[model samples]
Each structure stands twice: as C-alpha cells, then as structure tokens.
Target: MANGFEAAMRMMRSRDPQRAEDGFGLLRDRAAEYLPALIEEFENEQADRGLRSWLLELIGLAESAEALPVLAAQLNSQDEMLRDWAVAGLTRLDTREARTALWRARANGTIA
Candidate 1:
C-alpha cells in the first residue's frame, strides 16, 4: 500500500536526526492508528538495528497492552538496549502479560 505510512516510515528511517524525530513523533501521536503498521515494521527482518530500539521505545510510549507480546519478545533480545526499552514498555503497559514478562526477564538475570 502506498499510504503516507510508507513516507512516514522513510522519515523515521532518515539519516537526518530531525526527520527521524518528527516521524517518530507522528507515530507516537497516532500510536493507536499506526501501531499495527509499526508492529509490522518492527517484525521486518531487514529493519535497521539502529532504529529497532527507537521503534521499541515508540511502541512502549504507545502504552497499549496489545504491545505486551512484542515488548516481551524484545526482553530476550541480545541487545541490552532493547531489553531496557522493553522493560519501559512493559512497565507502561502494566498488563498481566507485560508484568509476567518483566518478572521473567528479571528472574532470568536479564535485567537487574
């Protein structure tokens, strides 16, 4: 689909920090509207490593329980940064699933 979402996605991936910031803001402002697409982008195998944590932060900012699984999955990522953002996301979500994942991560010694 050639929706403006693709354009926003490009901006979010821009080399220019400001463009990426603006795009992230757009996604955050419309988190409910853009979450499904954002989640799809998050799952893209070719997704940039630099932006993966950023996207995770934005998803955390969305504070949607539907994001619990995605955030929880990141808790097990080798990237400690992703684990931190996932913790923040799970905290924001505060759902049972999110909480359980947080506990599991802590128990597994991933997060202190």
Candidate 2:
C-alpha cells in the first residue's frame, strides 16, 4: 500500500487530468492515515511548488485539527494561492483555533 501511495503521489503531480484525478482519489480516501506524511512533504519538499500546494490541499481537505497550524502559517505566505487555500482550509475547519487564526489574520490585514 505504501508503494501504491507513492505511485499515487507521483501520478498526482502528473500533468494529465485523469492521472491526477486517480491519484487524488486514492490519497483523499486515505487522507487521515496519511496526514502526517502529507504535512511532512508539504513542509520539507521544496522542489515542486505544485506538489506542495497539492499536499496542502489534501491536508486541508483532511479537516483534522492537526492541520490547523500548517494552514494558519500559510495565511502569512507571500504566495496568494497558498494564502487563499489557507483561508479556505481554515474556513472549512471552523474550529475554535482555526477561527481565531482567521480573526488574527483579518486584524493583521493578512486577509480581507
């Protein structure tokens, strides 16, 4: 399954929509179990911006409390796309911490 997971990750980075969708389906199904790995990849893998963004999306979609800090930190990202995803993630989470972070970002003018 780990090998399958790795393959799916590679497929997720593919330019082909079908491949990416298949990969996304597999990862999304196992997101909770793979949340830590996804976060690790997002944090440490600096080579592929697209891959990192995908990882962030999956992390956000997981909707776990563990994803709070990762999403919140991205609110300060210079990358507007990442910031947008962060806001979306936090909004989707709707936890106390997530809301607090959103409020702080609003107060700081990090978001609208």
Candidate 3:
C-alpha cells in the first residue's frame, strides 16, 4: 500500500496533466500519511515546472498549515514563475502569516 502510494506520487509528478491531477487527487483524499513525503517531493522538484506547479496546486487544495514553510521558501526562488506561484499559493491560504509573506514578497520585488 505504501509503495502504491509512492508510485501514485511519482505519477503525480508526471508531465501529463491528467495523470498528475489524478494522482494528486488520490493523495489529497488520503493525504494524512503522505503529506510529509509530498511536501519533500514537491520542494525537491523545483526544476520541473509542470510538476512544481501541480504540487503547488495540490498543496493549495490540501490547505495544510504544514505547507507554509515550504511555500515560504519558494518566495526566494530565482525562478520568477516559481516565486509567483508561491505567492499565489500563500494567498490561497489566507492566513495572517501567508498574507504577510505575500505582502513582503511583493514589497521586495520577488512578486508583482
């Protein structure tokens, strides 16, 4: 079962949007145990734009406060797209910290 879940996560990182969305949906439904692993995979996959974006969307759907630090880290990403997505994800959270981070990123020119 664990291996199957891992495999599903790997599929979620696929280039195909449908596959990614399906896998992410599964994980999102059963995310209690997989959250840590998903966060690690998403953070490590910074080079894959599609995967990263999908991961961010997953994180947004998860709406776990645990994702705050990971999303915050991306605020410093050299990739403008990643930074923008991070800000957007944080805004989706709508927490005070998330809002503050978004404001700071915008002020610092990391987001626009």
Candidate 4:
C-alpha cells in the first residue's frame, strides 16, 4: 500500500493519459490517508502549473473533509482554474462546512 501511493504519484505526474488515469484510480481509493500530501503538493507554488491544476482537480475529486480548508482558500484565487476546482471540490463535499463556505463565497461575489 505504501508503494502504491508512490507509484500513483509517479503515474499521475506522468504526461501519459492512461498512466494518469490508473494513478488517479489508486489515489482516489486512498484519499482519506493521502489527501494531506496531495493538498500540500497542490499548494506548492513552485510546482509545475499543469501539475498544480491536476493536483487541485484530484484534491476536489477526493472530497475529503480534511481538504475543506485548502479548497475554500482556493475559492478566491485569481486563477480561474483553481477557483473552479475549489468550487467543484466544495460541492462534492456537500457538508455543512463546505456549503457554508460556498454560501459565503457566493454572498461575497467570489462565485456565481
């Protein structure tokens, strides 16, 4: 299982579509345990832009409560992609906290 996480990280970072899909499958299944690291990577500004976006998308797909803070933070990002992914993640979460965050963002005109 430990190695699976490493392999998934490597695969998801790959440019190949099939490899990334397989990696995403593995990562998604282990989201509860791996979300923190994934969120950390997503927060790395020095990371590759495409990889950062991909990481954000994966973080949204995980839908873990642990990811709420990061997802909510991204809601106000200047980057449209990040904001969109954050909204999707929050919607996926659908928890009271997530919904509240979304509501606040909407009220603030951060989202439509």
lDDT of 2 by residue, 1-112 (tens): 6787789888988989889888988898687788888888789878777777778888888889999999999999988888888998889899999999999999999999
- List model 3 lDDT by residue over 31-79, tens digit each: 5466677677786775677777767666655666787887888899876
Better of 2 and 3 by lDDT: 2
Q: Candidate 1, 95: how far from true, in Å?
A: 1.3
Model 4: how large is the Cα RMSD against the reference? 1.9
Show the lowest summed lDDT stretch of 10 residues, model 3.
54-63
TM-score of 3: 0.76
Candidate 2 wrong stretches, greater than 4 Å? none
List per-prediction Cα lDDT, in the order shown.
0.82, 0.88, 0.75, 0.84
C-alpha lDDT (0 to 100) for residue 72 of candidate 3: 85
Better by TM-score, candidate 4 or 3: 4
Candidate 2: lDDT over CA atoms? 0.88
Candidate 1 deviant stretches above 4 angstroms:
45-47
TM-score of each: 0.89, 0.89, 0.76, 0.83
Compute the lDDT for candidate 4: 0.84
Q: Ten consecutive residues with minimal summed lDDT in candidate 1?
A: 45-54
Kindly list the per-residue Cα lDDT of model 4 for residues 14-86, writing each as its tens digit.
Answer: 8898998888788876776778788876776455766677778778888788889989998999888889989
Question: Which pairs of residues have clashing backbones in candidate 3?
Answer: none
lDDT of 1 by residue, 58-91 (tens): 7888888778889989888998888898999899
Against the hidden true structure, what lDDT does model 1 obtain? Answer: 0.82
Q: Candidate 3: list runs displaced more than 4 Å.
A: 13-17, 28-33
